[model samples]
Target: MSLPPITSIHNPKIQRVRALLGRRSEREEQSAYVVEGVRLLEEAAAAHLHPQLLLYTPDLAPRAQQLVHTFQKAGVECLPLAPALFASVAGTESPQGLLAVLPLPASQLPSQPNFVVIADNLRDPGNLGTLLRTSAAAGAQALLLSPGCADAFSPKVVRSAMGAHFRLPMWAAAWDEIAAWIHQHSLSVFLADANLGQPYWQVNLRPPLALVIGSEAEGPGPQSAALATGYLSIPMPGGVESLNAAVAAGILLFEVARQRAAA
Candidate 1:
């Protein structure tokens, strides 16, 4: 089935896609987010997610064209846009000529979750995304983002995460909610602190544990800190005061993975 090309910027679908990509609130209200690039579109399909809308341009790569056809066969609404118009809303400097509007996955806690990561007030989207990727790689069952963290579904986050969003169960909630969930699940919580804490390797990172990583500027807030069963620190033998939030999280999460694997 052939669809009309959308050349006008004022087209409702174009406007909505732009809004979703630009604003977190809009994404929340619409229950949708935008994914771009051939790799992400392929990832979305591999994850068994159907896009509510798929947009492409004449310049779309052959691989992307085939994916578009696949979506079309699956009864997805696929449309074409003029290349210039498509680039206008694209997040990357070099547009890929393909994008999709996908429903936000439910933010439920994973069933039988064993390892989890809690991010507290992380403002950097790249950092948060990398953390998600690391957590997924380390076999974390879920992630919790405290208030003030960057929107997990933002374009930069989704891009940096490299499809972790589709695989990882994640939720954003307030401190009270996070604390409640932690206690209810009976999961031990460890806060990553640069100043004072047991070395990460020395800490037991068995299943049913949650690691809390804080913002770059400030460590975990007082409320979050108070909820911790213990604290962990990475040794800085090179005289470095601290590691980047994402790097620290990767190290801690993998340490947990290493222990679990050995056991």
Candidate 2:
């Protein structure tokens, strides 16, 4: 059942949403994040990701209204917000009619993963988000983040990812833990470097492997470099110095997929 529309900007629920939108720390502390837009909400629903709370405006279009109804029938707490109040807490320039407070999905790494992605010092949320999308599309079994990468669940990353969060297991761990996991899996670790090792296509990507992508500005840190069994460079005959981290990740990940498919 829908609660009475909240008119006050001081409402506790509104305040909680604002906090979640603004702070990564708050999200981590609560183990929840705010997800905005009809598209993301639809994806969440399709994945059977139930929300802890649903907030919407009264003037929602038919489809959005139906989405609100669906959540309501699922027994989620639905709160209607005044339009201005909704806009105030929304992360986007234009507020979507609906947003939700959802717990982070319980994604776990598989026991034996043939392919994985690791983000090393990738500070750009857009790049990291694109990497997440590409990694999921390429059938990576998991994504691991080193310390310096942007928070994967942040609003901008989440928006840029376009629902990729629901599709893969992700973890942010220390170098020690990462190295231990790689060792346990007995997987080869390859660093994607602009000028190093064999050409990416020549690499035998058929084995269980983890690809580490670093920042374009700083490249991989010592921690990541220490873990690489080898490096792979994309061939660029066009004379570009280096590709964007996310673009490089896409090219490499898809190559892995292509090679595995042909094998």
Candidate 3:
């Protein structure tokens, strides 16, 4: 049972997906985001996230066809689009001929999380995504994005995160909410700073701690800095100045994991 392909670019579904990919406002309005490629689709399935809509071309590879069939049988709204049309709206250079519009999962901090990551004023989608991925891998229980941070659900960030969005508890929040949450959890909050802070390794990262990484350009703002329980800096003996925001986060997060593993 083959479905008719969507050949017109003006089709409402096509237009909607294009809008979701191109505009942050549209994504927020619809409470959905677009994800492309087979690997991502597989990750979504593993995380048990059912897509609101699945679009693929008839030329999909054998494995992709199987996935489409699986979703279709599971009552997902699976549709076919012309290959060129998919390419026109796709963010990647090479289209895998599969994409989905998945609803944004509800994000909340865990009741008793031991570790959390706060990305303050992070502007780069690549860095934000890497931070999300690294935080998840390092076993942080939640992630918080400051008001000015990049859209975590943006296509670039989603793609780079490699499905961390589905697995990690994360959301954007204001400084006040962040401060309240930190205090409520009784977690020590450490701001990552290049200057005027104790060495990261010297700080106690055992558990129940929150690590904050600010923008590469401005670092954490005054409001965010004021909320920190302490400031931490990585020792760069080579005098390289500072690590990329994501790299610093990865180093500090894993150190927390390492300390807890031994405890």
Candidate 4:
């Protein structure tokens, strides 16, 4: 096997990686995304994804060293990078000094999804990312986002998603398109709301079901709201208006998982 290559920050390939790191369009155009941190890298590799390139700083731990060689042996082009340069390209505040360029899976949603979460106009990156992460962990089959929602594959979102992007099938479309998809699949669309809705535990989440959670600033969009098969909500004490988008989604997704597993 060829030894790893060492390159400077100004190298053309390195610059391209950094540029792609910042732009969602570039990531889509290249059909690859930058995965940072040791944990995420491990998840990507454990998922059996072949990295196009793996970049790491000199301070790589002994475990990271083993991974570098293993990944290199698996045909990944490992690049040794300077810590300062790695930090310059990282999206997180505490740089992990390691990242990989991974091609995203192009799996489309199933025609008839057993379970999913429809995100509408969700603007918060952290919330969206956490939702993706939780959805993947809870074993949701897919995620469909409305036009105004945060970009699922954006750097911040991807970082928060961890390796969820690789694990979950996702699509971004308009509310009308999403509604049409639900009907075509004969899906039971459940809209999560704060009022005039049954408690989530009251619903049967098994079979064809799509749970909808709208933007924090506003609830589900008009189209999804109108088409919702049922409006669902979690019963909360203390007179709270609602929970955070991420928390609410986690609850709903696990409920689906609970129902599906029991059934």
lDDT of each model, Cα atoms only? 0.90, 0.92, 0.90, 0.82
Rank the candidate models, highest lDDT first.
Answer: 2, 1, 3, 4
Flag the better candidate by lDDT, 2 or 4: 2
lDDT of 4: 0.82
Structural similarity to truth (TM-score) of each candidate: 0.97, 0.97, 0.97, 0.92
Worst 10 residues of 3 by lDDT: 200-209
Which portions of model 4 miss their true places by more than 4 Å? 1-7
| Regions of model 1 farther than 4 Å from truth | none
Candidate 2 residues 140-228, lDDT tens each?
A: 99999999889999999999999999898899999999999999999899999988989999899999999999999988889989999
> Per-candidate RMSD vs. true structure?
1.1, 1.1, 1.0, 2.1
TM-score of model 1 (CA atoms): 0.97
Off by over 4 Å in 2: 1-3
lDDT tens digits by residue: candidate 4, 1-263? 54344546788768878877788788878888778888888888788999888888878788777778789889998888767777777777997678888886775887657788888789898899999999899988898888878767777898889878878899887777877888888888888888758888888888788888887668877888788879888888989887898899998899888887888
- Per-residue lDDT tens digits of candidate 3, residues 1-263? 67789999999999999999999999999999999999999999888888999999999889999889889888999999999999998889998999999998888779996789999999999999999999999998999988989999999999999989988999788889888988988988889999968887787788588888998788889877888889988888899977899998888888888888888
lDDT of 1: 0.90
TM-score of 3: 0.97
> After superposing candidate 3, which stretches have Cα over 4 Å from the reference?
none
Best candidate, lDDT-wise? 2
